[model samples]
Target chain A: MAESTKKKKKGGRKKSDAEMEVKAEEASEQADVSEETTDQEAIAAESAGDETTDEGDNQVAAPKRPDPDWQKAEKPDLSLDERLQGLEEDQLRQMMKDMLLARRFEEKAAEAYALGKIGGFCHLYIGQEAVVTGAVHAQTPDDYVMTAYREHAHALQVGMEPGVVMAELFGKETGCSRGKGGSMHMFDKERNYLGGHGIVGGQVPLALGVAWAIKYRKEERVMQVYMGEAAVNQGAFHESLNMAALWGLPVVFIVENNRFGMGTAWERASSLYDISQKSKAYAMPGRVADGMDVLDMYRVTKEAVDRAREDSGPTLIEARTYRFVGHSMSDPVHGVYRTKEDVEEHKEQKDPIRLFADVLDEAGIVSQEELEEMDDEAKRISAESVEFADEAPDPEPSALYEDVYANEDVNGRLYFDGRERP
Target chain B: MAEITYREALNQALAEEMERDPDVFLMGEEVGVYNGAYKVSKGLLDRFGEMRVVDTPITELGFTGLGVGSAMVGLRPVIEFMTYNFSILAFDQVVNSAAKLLSMSGGQFPIPITFRGPTGAALQLSAQHSQALEAMYAHFPGIKVVVPGTPADAKGLLKTSIRDDDPVAFFEGEMLYNIKGEVPEDEDFTIPLGVAEVKNEGSDVSIITHGKMVHVALQAAGKLAEDEVSAEVLDLRCLRPLDTDAILATVAKTNRVVILEEGWPYGGISTTLTTLIQEEAFDHLDAPILRVTQADVPMPYAKGLEKLAKPSVERVVEQVNKVLYR
Candidate 1:
């Protein structure tokens, strides 16, 4: 009887620790709950211009966001006429459908991988769908796009065939990289999507280089590079930013601040999490957006991308957002540092795709039946991709000799003397 | 034929290469209106103007990365560090980004960049300011390491480096720039990378060295000649993808070898050459390869101590004598 009482006492102790985590998440999503992390909230608010903290030296005031005076912003009148006004309800409805389908697809990827179907590090951009969807839909295929490893949504929303990407993830020869590069290395140079880079801050320099190339070749191309907030701490980020600013390269640096770097929250890892404030260090324009809201992400990114093409130099955009899943598929929500309450709160209260769909429904632009139809289409497409990946042939043994080098110096011959294609 | 200093030959190479390719340009701290820190690029700015010949700020990491980024975009940027010692600050851009880009990108990207500057020790420059990093750089791939020992080779190699499809570390010896030599009169002349030339051919034993140390070996060979030892001297122009065939062939013929490198003895170029000859040319029955290198200590400012720390003709002679006698 006494031992049973002790077990009950132990259970009570576990419940309150869980409660403290719940309180932390609620306090984090809504507003301040912890006094120690209050400075982060105040700075974030200042960055968005939602609040001002006048009494503090620690408070980094919102940047002087010299947004392009769009009325005076130069564009060929013919080009402006051709620009997608994004005013159509159908167009918005279509984007909403894609976003929702992507949401379901990612959530399923998490579940499917949990059953051991996916083998690699599978990072889901479930909460931040709007970042890519909004930006990708706004740009034409001629523009260049590159992003970090949390890139499945970037690839899908960029209109890369889902089947190819899924097949690539499965390490099949028919996949994007012919089974060599898994998820973090999907690239389509033909489409001007320069990469999917694995290193955190390494891509920043390379992308700026691409922009420099575009300008040098007199090609009117814009290079958009995506990275996380924690990557800003690295030296290459700062070094590249300074050169880009000085040279006035046509590049856009986007920071997907999903509130955490792997397991540590931005508050714990960053003194100033709002990357826009740090953009001042380069003397470039910095903008903030509700990363969960597609419309806001669209407006800001479009403005930045236009400025870049106009040869007005680079812009740094910090998308304030959250991630619904763990850093990767292998991580479990309960077993990790984050509480289940936090993930549940994001899934229930602030689902970006759901939020956008709700807006369209209120406007009567898209109905429940139309949405369900798109969901079925996406699910079938996803299922077909998985099947295609399973069927995709592995690379031939003779392919090892190819692409290792350019033509050799002697007689312009191939470098490797290996089995030829049979 | 024309006689010119290695410095003048280098300037001439830059002038000719820039004239040939509009995409080729140069940028460094003191290379422009201020001339060059080594006076190697003395009159380039007036000829090329501010766009092609740029004077950069003191941010080595920033500008070197800029040069690297610029190179990836089809611009052939010849970056001049004040010296190899200063290049350490931008080593990441040099080694990680430029050297590894071609291989890691799976050969999709080519960075046509060149980092040229004075390397190794000269006189009493002292420790923090002096180092010879040939072996360290030779360890990496996708980078071509060129150390020219003569005026003709310097000009020809510099020309070839500017046109190569890879990043090149073209190190000029500080003390050898003003040394005059007979250069080819043919304006269209060029030398390919990875080729070693026999500076002085003899049969008793082969003395191998690169950069300024090549001069030491040649002088030692002359001294050994008086003692009836016909010491062969090989000037290793390109260090990486080392003319191993040439080294091995010379060792096989001479049947004895002595390597002279300017850097400290530990993991120096001498060690690499000795290891390779022993492994590949072991049956050639060499009388134990001898390495004459800088003493295993930090270089001191005292002229006497600095001279003692570096490879000298006297030491080279002793090593050659040891190999031949043994």
Candidate 2:
């Protein structure tokens, strides 16, 4: 057998050196199988008839065959000049500023969560700014955006005010959801940001439905639905993909593969490490983009958004990125599944905001002083959001009965009339 | 007026709604081309084409969520579930997404969707396929639950359900689909939801029921009249926004009451009606309100066992006799 065909496990270190040595010996022995028998058995297995006659009956069923078509989408490698080719200086500055704003806003949210000002699950979008920022930039205002719980950046990119979003986190009446929905349920009807759905992969089908509505109305709009890598395992994800492809709905499913679903790594949970390739089963084009690079994120998503707008079909784009913080505010930042050193290394080397700043500086689009000022402005806005949330009034007790139904005739009767119990 | 079967009435409602509004569409498993599992959506695909009448894969969660999403953006979607038993697969979407989206989103999105299908036991279909799920769905706050007893009511209520601006679980009794009744020929005919109808009025006893049980109650009432005892039958068309006024007025007239339902006794719709009667018409009642409910067990496949599991005409008469002290 070819040595390359022997599986090599690649991940964390083994707990014991003795165990590693034993595994290596076993792997070497398995790689010594005769090449001729392997080829003959392969031909026999592929043959149409079920013949009981076995030429190499004793040969251990060739270890489960790998998916031959399983190949990762090629990552584009554009030169700095090439990356900056089509981008205007103003647009580049705005994208960098948006990334910076998202980072600063999340940092404030984390601090507020620790201070007990914010409650429920507060998933910070610290290192994944470029994914939402660039994707939002590529789509028109008519486009719809739906995402999972980790969507503070998405809410901001889709034009929800910082104060209203923070106020929602504070559970105040002035919040976008009128304090009914907390951080994970942020919604803006005017902006066409569907929601920050709490259920994992729950919004995939809903997004397709929105796309269906757009197509039904003959509107030239696309729906962009975002989910995590881990959500690909959910049945709704596959169901939605199939329906979208079958109906030719105008939707782009963006999977932000940040490597970890909470503490469980993507490799630990999924058999297909490359989630984008799963789109092939539904007969849709799937692509991968560097999530840390804003320009690349925009370029790939723009193609998808255009295809959808033209009523071609749905596309699945997997954005490769990393999360600098833990899964949510409740999770400790380090020393569990991931180390503190790894977090620091990602922050120092590939922080999306920092990467965008470097690109801006190299292109001489924005100077260091201007970047520092932008950081200060973002900090000011984030601090004001905290103050606004603190000052916002609590929802009235009567507000509890509101919004359950749009038909007012059925609304506002919380209890049975003249009855002691509801 | 025209006499038609319950299935034909439902088909007419879907056809009319599709013709009335371009935004309205029907999608579900076997709803198109295959002509629906129960033939309730028969001829819709041929009439409206594939776009208006969609044939979805057997994905209840996906298609239900899709319906909710479409409704949120100003389209009315009629999503069929083949049967209420299979709707269990889409329970999360129905309860969490469709029902709660309006309230959770602060009224920004109103799900104008109808989840329609056959409910309750049919012949030998047992256990999973035989559940009457009105009590389960009516428990949620934001969604409406409507169960029609006759062909006319089926057509009217279904049209109302589709036109309503909120999510509605329109449950059609599997056993009642073939029953014929006179329905109005008006294209705009729609019975308002949350209203109860007095199918039969009598002076002796009040029998309150919904869906197929309404027929059973009427049969029991007929038998009681043969014995010189009069009985009134009140059909509750909608379960969620229950018609308390109609219930109270019926109790006032008859002075004695018996509640009948096909669902299990525990936490069933009968339990709610009993509480309402005791609270509002306690002084008018001559005896304690009695309830004839299904046995509290999963429906069995055996014909005898299935008959015992569901409410029967004899059981209703027995409950009425006990309430009347006759």
Candidate 3:
């Protein structure tokens, strides 16, 4: 099967695509040679009467044949027009509008952080708008969504009011989490957006448990947990995947491979080149989607969601994407870990919002004037959200003691203790 | 009422809670098939089946966080750590996720999960295996730390901890599991948390303690009575909600007090109790409160050294003598 795929790739190469054919051939040959060498080493170790080393050696040793089941499925080669063929005009417009709204909202948040209006660890999701927008499109209101700290786009995409999110960023009483949780910890129970966890890979187990609860209740709702490529290295991630597969949980583990985890690039941090390959270890199907293409992401995630709803179990997805902005507002915009040229290249060519906008234009679903009108509308809404955040009251002083527990009397006794103790 | 071992009492509480609330479930290493490391969850898997009584892999952080997440979505999960020492592996989930989620999410989620396990020194279990971490858990605000002394208190407090609408760190004494005492037969009977009980009342020196050390305090009180010392043994059932009024009343009645705990002296529960006594009942105190604690060192493996490292009846008696000016 692998040989046929390689032959097909070679046969399809045009004379003008000579360089691409050479690169593909080189990659295939390199993989085959590495596998051959690993197998030879394992056999040599076995003949040497050192069976103790077999365990470690066998982990990297190549199998006798390529695993057709474990191999990643080929991504569709559909053109933008072909991919957008079946999508209704209204839904496509809505997707573009939501992406623009997320982009503009983060732009305003960045401006607020610069002005010191927002405080404490503001993680802007400027470059990753399409990933969440497409995922939200794939999910139902009954499904649960959770993510890492970079989650303003997720909250907004899940139908949280833009004003509430901005207010949360501003630390006002009217925020989604009532000002106690700032930018890193947005939660809305009504929407079933579980949380925006601060710790890396912290939400993996929670997503597993939520899926387990849904299963226990005999409900068809699925859980979607998002994390960065770097979080795939965490123990909790492996543990969660193991349990999710063991229990046949209804979950979709989405890894937004944004190329960088905080300041560290994925290449420097991960041992595995493709994060989706991790699913093979758990005996589950792994898929890779073009995260910059909203329709592709939606199509892939919607399939996984449907599979989970049918009690078919979990799926792991590695959404190949890039974050054009720095890791956070604290990171320099240029020339620290990443070069300015790289950022500019991604912004110009692979930006999700820009790519989606171009698709809309090619499809004639939206005109340039309509695009500008949507942009203006997004800007106006973002500006209004900022204004609302600015005028919203600071959390009342007594709020410091509230929400600590469900029982108010316990809070009172804890805060207003009459008994003096050293 | 029926006489039962503290281990049996804990098992009864788990069985009763699992029977009463369909939402309640138990999970831990060796809890289902192996019948628990200490047999505290013996026969529970048979009664509750595999779903409600689960045997998890050695992944502590994974299942602990799972319990926290399950509790958030309307389930009462009782997570067991084989020993409190093993719980250190899951401290991030316990502290950052379970304890702080309720407040961090602005009361949108309430974590009604109980992390229970055998704690403190148990015979020759070395430094890593033997640690009383009640005070460490009590230091956090959103978590309630419960340390039940007797079998009756164990069953009662375990039931209450399972039902409470907060994250609870129930540190059961390793040494007290086999100790037998009279426990109420009623399935609905429960003891409220944060309430101290007078295990043995007297008039001279007050011996304040909790967990397994309560047994030592009671034994020392019996010895002190022979010397006409009349020591009062006040068992603190819960550490976080330190029952200051009960502690102060005991101090006012007895005047001289000795705080005993089987934990490191530095920042131990005894230290907190001593400070509370001196601040609230200083005028009532006849002498400065003295604390009897484990030797400020890691528990050694040798039986003799382990005995020396923990709080014993002799040490409690000696502290009582000093507080009594004998």
Candidate 4:
């Protein structure tokens, strides 16, 4: 059985002409060489017994696989134009702007992190913009959104001001978390964005609680939680899924399958490559979306959100996506586990922003000049946010004692360390 | 006031709070249909229905996080851990999510959630089930830790915990559940957290404690009275918002102190009180503070070893006598 033929059968769609052009551009010899390199590296690294105790060891090699195989895994049909139907021109333009804004914001964040303006583990959402933006497009402002540490894009998508998000990175009082919660914890209660929880799969159960509240209150709201593919291995993920399905709660579980959990590939870390299939154990409908295509992501997420709001129960969506950057600011873009060629191919062929822009252009929904203007506008907003964060005041030293308890007056002495309060 | 068991007091508090506020709901293992593992939620399912009194699968971490999440969204959720030992399974959600959510979110969300469960040794339930976890919980800054030793305190403190806009870790005494005491009849009867009560007043020495240890301290105080050495018994109902003024007052009055706790001596609440007394009221103390704590080892299953492991009235009395320089 040929691998390409198998993928075609599972995809259930013939390749579009544009896809064929990109495929023809990739030399077959280059793919073969990268496959050989991956196998040799995996075997050599395994035999050497190279184990690292370093916490920043994002260079660990994943289990060997032919480089092209995981890339050709099944995805939604590529007729992104179909997804543009029933949407007004303004909505499509907003979606484009939102994705661009996320990309531009992260680019600025990466720059700030390099200049020592941001501290702590800053995980940028550079390449995975479409996944969150499209999912947000499917949600109402009243609906809740929660995700793991890689959530700058999720914050922007859920309508958090870029200035506040940047200020959070800068640890300013004006940050969404009031300078207390740094890079990994972004929260906006008014926008219904729960937080940027740092722990892996930690936000899923919280999402379940929000969903349970919605069900208990007899409200027609949905709670959507996003996590990386690595979080699928967490016990909380399975436990949350079981309860969400058992109670028929209105929640959507989205696993942004960005191909890598830091350095380890999804295929290397997971026993089963197909993460959506795990949802079967929880008795929920498992759907997969082409995460790079914003329209397809919106379509699948909308269907799940509708089902949940109508009280049909939760849906588990495996949004097949890729991150164009390192796991965090400290890591390299591509090395150790993945080849530079592989990264380049994905960047050229499936860069979510570029792909969406092309779809918009081909469908006549957006002009090239309009897309350029949107990108420039996004850059301006992102650049100004940096200035805002740079000038934002630091939290007052008195703030150290504040917010430890909701009603500290009634709770009595909260700080026991004997630090004098000014 | 009405005579009731500690169990009944907790039940009354849950029922009254749920009845008072529609947002207040109870969730835990065997809480609804099974009427709770310790039957603390008995008749709540029938009274409030399954929606308010929820029965959940044994996913402690999941359900606990769910409760925190619900509390984040303005619902007052009372999550019952079958035992404080089992709460270790949900420790992350308690410490990481529930306790830290307020401070970490920069006070955006106030988690009005209560994690109540039977704590401390009950017969030969062994190490896993018989551990006291108040010290570990009280260590966190954002959470309020309460231990109600008597029926009245159980009803009053629990009502206050549910109403407070902070996450509260309410530790119920497993051995004191069936103990009877007088409880106020008022539905709104509530005790303020972070307040200490003098269970018995004296001036020779002070036996300071909380939770089940309060009874042991009182017993020791009675023994000291017989020996013509008066001892003050102070019960610190809440740990995080510690009654520092009350503790200091007791220290000043007694001039000697003996701290007691059911947890291990190393890093126990006793260690904290001793440090606090020496730091805040050093000149007032006549002798170094002593602590009566569980043996520095895991709880044993055998009767003799288990008895030896726990802090007893004899141990508390011995510590009091030592502090009094007898």
Best by lDDT: 4
Per-residue alpha-carbon lDDT of model 3 for A1-422, expressed as tens digits?
23224433443321211232344553553465345544545676579765433223233323232122111223566666557747789989999999999999999999999999999998887777878888778889889999999999999988899999999999999999989899999999999988889899988988888887887778889999999888999999999999888888899999998777788777567645566667868877676777877887886787678778875488898887778777889887654777898778778877888888888888888989999999999999999999999999998877876677654333112322443432
Segments in model 3 whose C-alpha atoms lie over 4 Å from true places: A1-74, A79-82, A408-422
Taking the tens digit of each residue's C-alpha lDDT, what string does model 4 give over B210-283?
Answer: 99989888888888788898888999988978999999998999899888899988778988888888888999
Ranking by TM-score: 4, 3, 2, 1
Instruction: Give the Cα lDDT of each candidate.
Output: 0.73, 0.84, 0.83, 0.86
- Highest TM-score model number: 4
Estimate, for each residue in A1-422, the C-alpha lDDT of model 2 and write its tens digit. 01111111111221121232343443443343323234545676669454433333333334222122111234344567767747789989989888988999998998899899899889998888889999999998889999999988899888889999999999999999999888888899999999978788899999989999998888899999999988899988999999999989999999998888999877667755566657767877677777877887887787688778875489899998889888998988764887788779878888888888888899888999999999999999999999999999999888877888777574213234443331
Model 4: chain B TM-score relative to the native chain B: 0.99
Which docking class does model 2 fall in? medium
What TM-score is obtained by chain A of candidate 1? 0.77
Off by over 4 Å in 4: A1-81
Better of 1 and 4 by DockQ: 4
Worst 10 residues of 3 chain A by lDDT: A63-72
Q: Quick one: ranking by lDDT, best first?
A: 4, 2, 3, 1
Report the lDDT of model 1 for residue B188.
81
Q: What stretches of model 2 exceed 4 Å from their correct place?
A: A1-73, A410-422
- TM-scores, chain A, per candidate: 0.77, 0.81, 0.83, 0.84
lDDT of 3 by residue, B193-267 (tens): 778899998999889899998888888988888888888898889886667778888898989988888888898
**Candidate 2 lDDT by residue in tens digits, B124-215:** 88899999989999888888889999999999999988998989999999999999999998999999888889999899999999999899
After TM-score superposition, the amount by which residue B296's alpha carbon in candidate 4 deviates from its true location, in angstroms, is: 0.6
